[model samples]
Target: MVADAPLRLSDTNACVDAVIERVGKNITLGLPLGLGKPVRFVNALYQRAKDDPSINLHIVTALSLLAPRGSSSLEKRFMGPFAERLYGRIPELAYARDVSANRLPDNVKVSEFFFKAGSFLNNVDQQRNYVCTNYTHAVRDLMALGVNVIGQMIAPGDGSGQVSLSSNPDLSLDLLPLMREREAEGTPVAVIGELNENLPFMGQHAAIAETSFDVLLEHQPSDYPLFSAPQMAVSPADHLIGFYASTLLRDGGTLQVGIGSLGAALVHSTIMRHKQNDDWNAVFDRLRVADRFPVATEDGGTEPFREGLYGCSEMMVDGFYYLLDAGVLTRVVYDHAGLQTLINQGDISQQVSLDTLDVLRREKLIDSPMRARDVRWLTRFGIFRDTVEFKGGRLRVGEQSLDADLDNADSREAIRTLALGDRLTGGVVMHGGFYVGPESFYQALRDLSDEDRQRICMTSVNYINHLYDHAFGTQRLKAAQRVHSRFINSAMMYTLSGAAVSDGLDDGRVVSGVGGQYNFVAMAHELPDARSILTLRSTRQSGGEAVSNIVFSYGHCTIPRHLRDIVVTEYGIADLRGQPDEQVYLRLIRIADSRFQQDLLKQAQKAGKVAPDFTLPADWCNNTPDAVRQAVTRTGDEELFPAFPFGRDFTDEELTLGKALQTLKAATSTRRGKLVTLWQALREKDEDGRYAALLQRMGLENPRGLKARLDRRLVIHGLRKLDTPSDTGSKET
Candidate 1:
């Protein structure tokens, strides 16, 4: 491999062959999570390992996305066309598919720090192999495993000797240092990049010289479409959860949101608060948000954003785009520590006024007579015009050179007149590690102007996930940029003791890896004004039973009781940051579903965690599913809570059918529920023309067999149930 240029290979097999020759048969491959995995090269390498049993391949990564496959026949029929149509030419990850099906070759062992949410619930292999670590420690863990080969899908630059890590620079940027160290030690190591034309070429820290890679797989076959995640329907419960969480956000603050419908809901609510304050206030008032939970009014706000928000998240979710479109995510933080600190302190504005340079001088950041280095630094940060030149203790503009000394009044005037720019450039509105979403998200990034694209920096996870960054960003800079921060994420359950269960079940089945939730939660405690918020539905349908997510105790805890902060459900918000155990129990129960509150309270009382004499308040007792539905529907505003806040990939028919299928699946999850659903389907009337389009879509219009007829009847029953209004979280048919 050349120092100035990568060993470019157009063929996938050639790249794999080069890697094998360099790293021998025993290869420890480290691929980036999600969309950045170099599919072609990895497939070829894995194939080689399979064919030659002597080769041992250990692949380590997270969220290796495979196209969705439905288990039942009807689900397959519904999802088949949708998946094929959306992800037709996209290269499927053969490793993920094999690993999922438990058919991995004995020689190839795969490990992941994070699984796609709920992907491997019953797989003992995945559960046993799951690496428990934060997102910040992924690089460290990979190095400890002696990873020698790194693979990624890169975006091409403008014919320069550069490329953007594009969707994922997360671990690759962090691992570069270690890879370099191995190379210096003469240890065989490889960095392979497969170029994709569809990948959005993001700049900032994501851009690096092509020499970073030792092997390049660049051609048509390898440059397939990137894997995309379609938008899921945001339930009424999710919207309510988002609405409650939105009130906890300060106007001028920092935000860290995860990827999913819940995060999207929060962004939508925030947008509504900013754009349609009247509608937002109506919902807030109707829900008695201020009256019940004064923490919202005391710590958070309900008014429009005057200072806006700066997004500092691990994943650059599509919701940020909606917020950006609404002019709500406009708070930009600079790269320089002093400049960002001044902006945060209100000592200087982004507009390149004379105060910008004056503040820098006052902070002892620059000399009275600016040195050549100071001139370069000012121009680099957009404080000065590029046309202004500093040489020999003077400021040069075209032909005229004036005194550069700020102490001289005449020189100051001359410098301000010639060197000032309109506003600050190089300030980033969002700092993210990686992203995966619907086609619109990728297209949105592709369609952005170069100037606009730079506003959302796709950098290493070390930068956005925590404030302990020594490379990409410093603790001081992150602290200064983040003010009154709200770190929002989703959890599956919460205990009365204030512990949060997010990643896995008590049975030792891995649902998803603890990627950055722990990092943000710990950081929230460290930051003076920041709060970590975990959101979940109050009640969820599990095995056809309405189970309470707020439990008395849980075996697995992602966020322990000591680190508990804010938790939001459809009913209300529970601030458990500094509260006692009994107070935590009371607050959690008040926000739980009305049906389960009694049992939860009884359990708490029996365990001596809460007062047995304490009875539920009448106002809090109405925290039911119907109450949440009535609250949203009574507003008479459709735009207040939408299923798809940003644009959706699903069509109207698909949306209708998908929702009905979900209700059917939830209703019939257990034997008793299935029997009841079967009885309902047998009595369902099919003479109506209302479901003609839906029947045609599901291929149940003209059934030729008994199974087909039964499926048709089930479809009709589901469609009929869809017309009836129920709680968003209710799975009952």
Candidate 2:
């Protein structure tokens, strides 16, 4: 029987009951990765599974957004208050709680295709159960593994009652038709949807028929907003990395960026190049971008963009809005191959007018004898309206008619001047798979006029992640539009051989899954002019000790050394594509942190990956974090490198406390540091009352116990450290 019109359930329990009735016991459930999970329904289902052992549950999903619960007293004291303030009213994830506590029942098996970065690093069960797959193939792989039930959160419908996939149309759109097919075959596939009014109702493929789902759940939308990824503070090192990556992007090129501090920094730099050219150019000169990377000048350009860029990303981040607002993302490429080619070659602008038609005709892109199909193609590009029709050998638009036989001189002139008319504008600045941004980003999308919304096409991940079209012919329109594509992704560690380890540890524990990084890397190599730019911080602090992220070799690789194209760090960029093993090693070491470079070079030399005769340059030796800060500050504009470029969720006071708490946590990571911090704190004076509210926020205003007093002292020490300027300067040691 055809799936009945969506049956609205009263509560989450009712929804669970309906799911049980539909799919029965021993069911395999599928959920969207993140943001699109129906929290209430998932919690109820998990509860039911706990009560009923016979109902074996295999939950296939990824990126469970769990609240941070500190492991120790000090950690708890700091994180508890911070989480409460930053994540107000956002419901705790029941599944994540079970996984974190190892309280999951034996009958229920939770397998994730992706982890919320570093969330499952310590969880043995999650690490062993992690599914290795790309983002574009997630749904397909899950279906092949027999996921009988699929559920997701959605935005409420408009007047016609058409609900939208909203925050996550990522894989839902791809899975819906498959579910429908299964339902038709009497296999009992259930598509569950819950309406959350807080989600912005997106257009395009995001909108779906009301009857598409087998069961629908709705309630008075929560007063709280959707879960937002708090904006990360951009450091000077992050700015340097962004500055290097920005220099590699050519004008009128395609860009694919992920969501993070690096993305925000990159957008800031791109905007500066467009709006504040003098300042941007001056910074480039200071960095010696043209001299250091001569390949950048050949592959990219140092000049400010005369023709702006077009965005094509799997995730439409908040920074895209900032880029759009600053007029840096104004390159609009159409879906048609001919039109895109003309735009790429600078033969035609996005503004389609009579003059552009004349140019197309002069270039022989348009035929003199325009056929009926040609008229239809022109109409699709907004060159002609629906009121215009080509009948016989004439163009009929309302009462006015013009001859289409351009072979006749007068007819050709009339067709160019009058037939096309002045109404000419059709192109998209970006083609995104799905979007999850801050409240401001959502508001911007919600407030857009229908016409404006059309310019930001929201499609499926399959198109953005892959070049070959599975649905259409092999020669897809998307493949043609993607020109000089730069796929910028981040990695946790990289080997000397250019191998990347983005998701898992060398010991087999997963930090995060291979989302779309591999897919982009593969695509970069496939496309002739495209390049994958992997951005990584040279070092990270672990347990109060600094560790180099660039290693001699790694046990497991996400993007193998063979696929490596461009690797960038705060110090510099390493163009590793097709380079010898020794050259790749030397280039990566050159861009590594100064403290770690000698050690890395020694390791590489010991392994015979680099020549022993090679020596580091004197100037390049100053690749310290302090050096990066000094270089960035030399511009003398504090506003140029604000922590959060777009916007931040935390208040000014919260940000201040957060930074202090972070410092305290860093200091307390080691016993010796903790003792030193306490001693320094006890010797200091707190007469200014600057940390009064901060102490109160951390429950350290009035110390009642020994631990509380120590914690208070730690905070005080951290604050004092922040107040004092570092004496390290640009020294390597």
Candidate 3:
């Protein structure tokens, strides 16, 4: 493979040329489809095609095709209610246009775009043209689209050399082996770009030599900014849902968390228990206790929960980082590491030393420095040991252990000192990057070495497929059973039970997008041990009138009847999963919003979906939203409300703009022209003067106003509010 290879790496353009030379005219690019590198590659491909028309560029993957015109709001699109408010008012505000321009690069066309079918991550129906079973299938489909050469543009190590396609491992799917298979056949010319130069990772089937890629381009790795946890107002209802879900979490159970307010709030709540409840802290302390007086049990005489909960799943997001920081999880082992080493590694068996813990404490990796109280509590727990080594002399359990001879008296004292050094510090987990929101958690995980990194079970990218297969397997773990739950959320679930869930008010088209609610419902029926938990917010207040989320029916049904599972509200849990039509309606009505229960029961009678004798349960009727609200409400201290529980760092002005934009969105939905005119006025305003004034206020020279008009919306909107200066900083009406 290394016959006449050059000694050093080639540049990006040189790599492209070499690949072209090896293969010939037509080329296909299997890109990591995100807004980041893919956009640049497609732009370059179009530019390249301007000169060399023979080189073909085809894309085969899912990309987030957003609504056009982006958000009129100042914040980023992915942020919660702000985005919902902005996008939801589409028809009235004319914001329903596709965000991603449908127009393709002049050289590359959508006709050549291949998509993945049955994709859990993206919308299947929207993905038109050629579709395949998976990412690998999509790649193969690209070859059929007249692609003779494959181009991979992943950033390499140190951001400056050729990176083997194998090295950039992802949970989704790997393309290297398939690429090699094509190479074994007649196909050749793999172009691999190595961008990063500092620390490069080496693992898995992630190895490719210089000969593997005809072109090895050197460029800087694209510095993708980390996604900070977004701020959100965790409503009383949402917090209750979180508390219920928290109960489902076992002490040692692994967690798979989705992104957004729910997951972020969950992380915050878990952290809160350490400060709020002594029992929670005690449980954590006992679990961290070491096995000094090892029980002679067959389970290796080791404390069972001592290893703590291992995070195993695809996303290595903030929550995983949180567990690591809290000392609830430690020890990561790579797949290839020998199993025997698991028993022998000192770091694997031991807790973090006091010195390490102190260092982290000083650095603010943890919330605070360890106090005498902490040491006493930790000592009372099993985590801290009382042995010593002679080398370091006197060592505390929270400090470091001595290496002095155990035979001598002095050595024994040193060993005892060292035993005291052993404190509860995180050990061994795979982690990287800067996490500011949940920094403590991130710091703990990253404190581990690469070998120990594997033990963490933090990445479950393969679980998507593994769980899919496991659903049919004999023994069911927690992960497999959850897949069946997806079916209840399916769009047409109720249709199977001879009922539909749509509102009759379809006077004109609404701005509602077809979300993934239906897909989950369908999957619920397909898998065992899985059911959908349909959540309705009870009553929604609009225009001074409170409307029930549970209507006689929705104008559009995200999920149908047969797919309903346990529907929960403040009223109570309504077990509807696997119930007959009459029972389902009766149970659903029992737990619906209090104000609409009577009306819903009458309508259910009209539709014959309910039993004629079904009556609203008296006990269930007693618990209303107001009652539930009062029960959980704190007398004072707005911070205790759990609104923005994970918390946000935005200025008050930004908050006002966010709320105003939300109001505009709602107004636009019911009334037209108002939002469009407001948006136009905002968009047309000269932002340069404002930016210059901002720079002057900061005592810095102003940079040219080169940022796009849309980019300035966030800052401008915030600044615009300061000019008004009311208590809430209300903008001019």
Candidate 4:
């Protein structure tokens, strides 16, 4: 590649041909994990590699967002039409299709750093080829394995003649500079970028020059919409967990949240606290938040946010947007150390004006003999224009020049009035490494004004995930801005000893990679005023059975017991930090579901971790899902605890059908239930027109063959069961 090479604009096929011509056979391709992969370009490459086996292909990526294809007949009947309606006009993912069908060519190999939800559960090839690494270190590990070509999807910048990495600057921002360095040293590396108008034009480090890529592909901005994960519904159990977690949040603190139903629930509860404080307090009173969990009161605030919050997350999900719109994410932190220190000490607000300058001078935060670096810092913050120059005790802006003598009243007055203006008013409300949300989220980001867009800084994962001691001179500033930080994440299972298993199973099969959960856990302990809060449901449904998530012990642990801080379930909150083994075991059991509490206590006693005569309190026996629902339902406002608080893609009818289908699937999961369901289905009748539309929607309207008739009968019986209001025992597995 030549230095300052002109970016060649070409079609997808031409771009792939150029790449193939350059790298020839045995090409090692690198792409971002999620929404960043260029769909058309990757599809063309996959087709080319498939046609010619001589051209060996090694694809490296993770989290390929593909529409779900059901593995069973019943699942297929329900999901086929649902996915078609949900994902309109989005092109079929080629690599995902081939992998799902187990039809990859002999010369093509796919390696992933992370797997999509249950995508590799039974696939031997993908399981064996998985690469386990953290999100912040994925690029380093891939490059060490000699990944030579990189491609990604990007959005057009705002009239800057540049492009934005948009949702996936996580690894590319750190990898691009290194790729350029290698090219400069006579090593050929190809960086391909494709422009899609639907992606949001993010600011900060996500914006890059057009020349950063060797080849570029452009299509109509409306030709493709950004791929997104549909928002899941928040159950009553999820809402209760959120209610407990909300009491543990400080007013003027930093927040970190992930993408899931739990994260959505947390955002909902926080919004309620800020917008409807009386209702929130009522719910808190019913739950006994202060009485049962005194640590929440000691560390967190119950009153509404007067100072607001700032967000520092590895992935910016749509929940943050909802928080921002509700005015709960209004706290701003600056990038300069002096300003951050003042803000941390409550000496100055986010508004930067002459009053701020006066406060700085009165506090002696700045001196008269200003250093050159200080002048540059001031310029960077827009305190002075780019034309301003500092040299040997003098500052010049445009045609005006002033001495750096702070003691001189004239010089001080001139500097304060002229150099410090209202241009440096805004500060960042959030700093995120990358973002991927619903289609509405992308539209919200794209419609933001330049000023609002800058407030949500998109940068590298290193800054958001860990404290970099060698981050030039900004480490202290970063640390100061992160005071009273709370990193909230989700886990799958947690042991009585406080060890958490989030990313894998005991059999050593990978469910998901260790992506940034460990990073936040470590950082929570490393920071003085930070706490890591991990949330999980007290029980999970598996194979038609309800299993307790709080186990006696787990074989594998993603986060060790030593790093435990706070864990929340629907029942209550557990503060395990620095607690003894017996105390930790008891606390964990206290928050478990009532059905499993006795069994957990017995297991703890057997292991000698707790006393033999120990028993759970009678007051804590109300830790059931039914109790959670009744408490929220008694508020007389059903909308307060909705499935999707912000918005949803599915229609009301679709949601109803989906729920009925889920109940049916769960009913037929066991052998005895299957036989009983079959017997009931044979005697049932759908003579009424109530379920006609649903049957047509599921493609079982007119049954012809014996198999189709049997499927329809079973579906009809399941639908009747769903209509029965008394049946609440079934859960989706």
Candidate 5:
């Protein structure tokens, strides 16, 4: 009679059976992007499909995280131990593994809306099935494809009587209402959740009642370690690019950055500006940033933050954690629209007083004679103490009872004496949708107190990415919160016409899906005080040669010329928001690598975008590979711009060997370079046991076969150079 209302909570295998039974053979199950998928349930279902070819299963998702499994013998030898140390027993998603290796059966199909940034360049199957959609539009598109079942990894909660959608509330919170609507329309839709004890419990909108799920699975066998990717080294070019971008951030602004060393570099620079203002000022003055591009000085700052920033990134990378620790991300915003606006206009301080109540009363957010709802709202934000209670239109403080009329002077005095708090509560300093980072980041989050963890709200992507929807608040409130916002993202190639190439190539093969880059860029144009800053190295190595990332034109564009606001490379900054064609061309060319400026200028002249007789400026023609290196050296900050600003998981031997191997790989990328490397390796007189530890780490200490001997020789040759350049730039196909 209750229609299975006893609350069916089972294990992984039982839940998999229930899902198949409810959704039938042709199930288009939906999974959350990244670390939130139910790995055990998904693997069981995939095995069922693989074992029985009659079962048709098509799944849709994005950013499927995979642990490293090196492709070749040499790479395997290097990464095997490293992988075991990091991702110990994390269960790899069977569908992702199969789809990546082109080993899926005929009856199983998997598609993703995003890839882990250039992980699928030559993958024909993944490139073909990739669904291109903005991050905010994922739920609508997933529904259009007839997604019937959904599953997620959840924190079962620490006796809080709620389940927390930790790590990912991005897509599932947006898709749940539609799934319920379909169920009401006589369609079979299953909502399943698998419990993981490792995820940190995220409160607020991410926590929901346990009755929300149709089936809940808590199994001991499924308890595995969460995946933690190794943090890579930040290059010298990344530091300078980050420094240039840091100059553009205003005090008390908003920030949204992606996950990687580039964003960490920017965070490092921002922290430097805050903690070591003298050094930051020194670097700023030495680079002559104000002379060539006055926008950095006029529109930005070189001093420290008087009022800290608010983080509004969709992915809460570890950089935000660092900022929070350094007291740089301490600016918080409340949920009340009127109060947020007042805070933005500086009418009331975070410190609560009689003035705050007066402002709220004047704004008519609360009535003179407070109702129950009004009293509850005030107490919820800690404007009033919990000791204050409302009963029959009267206020009850700890030992005093008084009338609740704020317009009356006696009642207001009573409130100020007993009910008012010193500061506001229920304000968030950061709002993010999903998060993925190093193991240390996860541990830091898990170790936070309940009070501190709730200050970072992990909510739906709809609320975080754009202000078009009214699910959370109005666009006006968002505008007030996101003041002078900076959305810094990476780019693959930039054209002289001010277009950015980020996701794909001209041949229509996607390097990564258009996940949220377009959403943020379009949002940057919509917000009046906001700017989109695209960062890239001035040059990248291809075929053992440095090639300019700034080109005349590219076949495809991610952000069109009309949407370009700011572009930052190691050379300098280019302001391109509302400039003319000639000005955009000149500014972009001036920031290009010095070796490629003339060629780019000639191409622009051939296209008639620039004048035929235009001459390159003298001051902007010194953007060599070593320019940033030398500038950093002059400032005596080589130690500050470390290879890994954050602590690393790699061993000491591994770090040295990894860099040497990278140099060798670059040296062997071309035919001529390969010949030179081979000849040099053959004649290497590495007799002195200088590379004994490195050789033993790579498993090449004693060689037997010809291949092993060659590997040993290559290792010896790779170890000959220890002073290799630190700026191995970002690469793309």
Candidate 6:
């Protein structure tokens, strides 16, 4: 009798064991880290290695272990008062702050940090939870480090005795080389996930087979925690910043946004502009900026935005969701299944349109009598306003509307208004490989009808890298064109004079894998109508000092100066792409936090990148710490402005700890020995609990000083900030 099938699907734990066994002597092991099997499985392996003395395990995933080398919004949230409470109770331990600094423990080490270099440093690690970039590099590095075991998921039946590293493809085509080498060396043991059965089959290298992996894990698709970006209070500071960027966005401009706090803030601000019927677009027209939005291109379609704007980009994050609600992403012209199908697929690919208004009306940008039922149902998905009305086959709402029957002149003007209104509402594509946090927002989106849900894309299954590319691409090209501009408030957008951007530097080491920035930036330059904007704080605290992020040079640049398009701070915008050395230096100097502007200018002058006669703009020079504080203040109290504009996903204690941590950091930076004294004064019981809490904030990690050390090193490189000895001995450390 024929033997039973040799390749039965393995149970989750059995799959994990088989992969681990296959990894028996592989030198490197890489997997995505987050809430899913990717993270759980990888962590399990690490724990196993911790127990097995023979196993020399090294992980290349993006976890708290690989956080940036400086204060992160996430870290600050955890380290603040939590540190104070724990260290306060044990004053003697406060001096141990440096114990967690740069030097890795003898047992664990990440030898090489890999990442795609780009302007925004867009990558998997920076987003809520991205497995592709994180997993790819981690695996690659493990092999390079002479790691004996490398474990990752693949489709069953895709393996040919040899394992295949397959899934969604990243912008970095070079990963194929690493895979080939691994397979050629007979080192790769593919661990496949059968979760793709229900996923849409994307085209190209994204396709994979069950046979490619050496071991197949037949468990149900991981149940990812649905995280929602908070609906933040849109402060005037955020509004003005978003407004300025919006002005740069022409009706058809393409865009790319990073993820996180500022991203949500920007989206909220944009939605407000739509609600208030702002005249922001007029500003862009008046400026006569380069790469103006195209009403119609060779693609032979008039962008509805010819009357206004549209957006296209990769992040299917909150920004994308907001765009859909506001109505900026209406489909004027579509190829296969029309707008609805494209929306459901969670993507759009097209060029500008000439007669966009007429075409869109014919195609249903306005409600047709035939589709009135669908339109009414749209309201359930939060797609329509209470004021929506149909007159002569056109959609009318509030003061503005879209009418197909108006004369050429009336239609032109009406179309502009309609486009603007829609631009305000639509153009967001949200996707995350792993989402962790509050699920309300996601549930809100998922609650929408298939057509409305089609407007949002949740990339549940794909390769670690390709998912990012799809997310980033959709964000830049699709979301930007529809929405005017987009925002990414995630992390680490390094600016070199040209051609590179790096993320996370610590004592000459890279902490995480290169994610999607390279793809986003390259795509940005290609999209004349679009821009890739990078956001970063002005400074970070290390040891007991504040370090400036606007440095003359980074020891390693995640995104080079050439690729540097636009960098923003609380101060202002620094447009650096395609600029001369002098221009770049001058522009960057203008936006550096006020306290360091003069120093930066001096350094620029010393380097001869700026002329001695180059004077700071009077308006730009007005920026000061107090001025920034005032800038963010609105009609309410200062404390009302949340560090995260949307909403805080953390607990009340966590928020308090974040605030306290910010205060402590400020104290540590300004006063020598204060970090230690502060630690002593604030230390409390449950020190381990505090550490654990911080770790959970970082997605459930054990307390370790590696991330903290990297932060300090980056501070030293970026702003020359260093920790004082006494501060290094903090009890929390």
The RMSD of every model to the true structure, in order and in angstroms, is: 2.0, 3.0, 13.7, 2.5, 2.4, 13.6
| CA error at residue 229 for candidate 4, angstroms | 1.2
TM-score of each: 0.96, 0.93, 0.56, 0.95, 0.96, 0.56
Which stretches of candidate 2 lie above 4 Å from their native place?
A: 1-4, 221-224, 353-373, 390-394, 409-418, 421-426, 472-476, 675-690, 724-733
Q: How should the candidates be ordered by lDDT, best one leading?
A: 1, 5, 4, 2, 6, 3
Tens digits of lDDT, candidate 3, 593-662: 6787788788888888877787776755754665546534532334443566644644443455555455
Candidates 3 and 5 compared: the better one by TM-score is: 5
- TM accuracy, model 2: 0.93
Considering lDDT, which of the candidate structures 3 and 6 is the better prediction for this target?
Answer: 6
Candidate 1 per-residue lDDT, tens place, 1-733, comes to 3367888888888998899888899899999989899898999999888899999999999999988879886788788878888888887888889998999999999999999988888787888888999999999999999999999999988888899998898888889878889878888898998888899999988999998988878895547877889988787888899999999999889999999889988988999999999999999998889988999998899989988999998898988888887899989988877788888888988778877778899999888788999888888888888888888888888897988788888887887888878888888889889999888888988999877788988888988887887886688888888889999999999999999999989987889989999999999999879999999988877786789999989999999889998999999999988898899999999999999999999999999988879899888888877777767678887656777778788888888888788878988999988999999999876785889988888888898899888888898888888887663445421
Deviation from native of the Cα of residue 375 in model 2, angstroms: 3.7
The positional error of residue 93 in candidate 2, measured at the CA in angstroms, is: 2.7
- Model 4, 550-631: lDDT tens digits are 9998899999999998999988899998899999999999999999999999999999999998778898787887787786
Cα lDDT computed for each candidate against the true fold: 0.88, 0.80, 0.40, 0.82, 0.85, 0.43
What number of clashing residue pairs does each candidate have, in the order they appear? 0, 0, 77, 0, 0, 128
**Per-residue lDDT of model 5, residues 326-426, tens digit only:** 88898898887788889988999989998998888899888888888888998999999978898867888866788888778988898898889889999
Candidates 3 and 6 compared by TM-score, better number: 3
Clashing residue pairs for model 5: none
Q: Total backbone clashes of model 5?
A: 0
lDDT score, candidate 2, position 463: 73
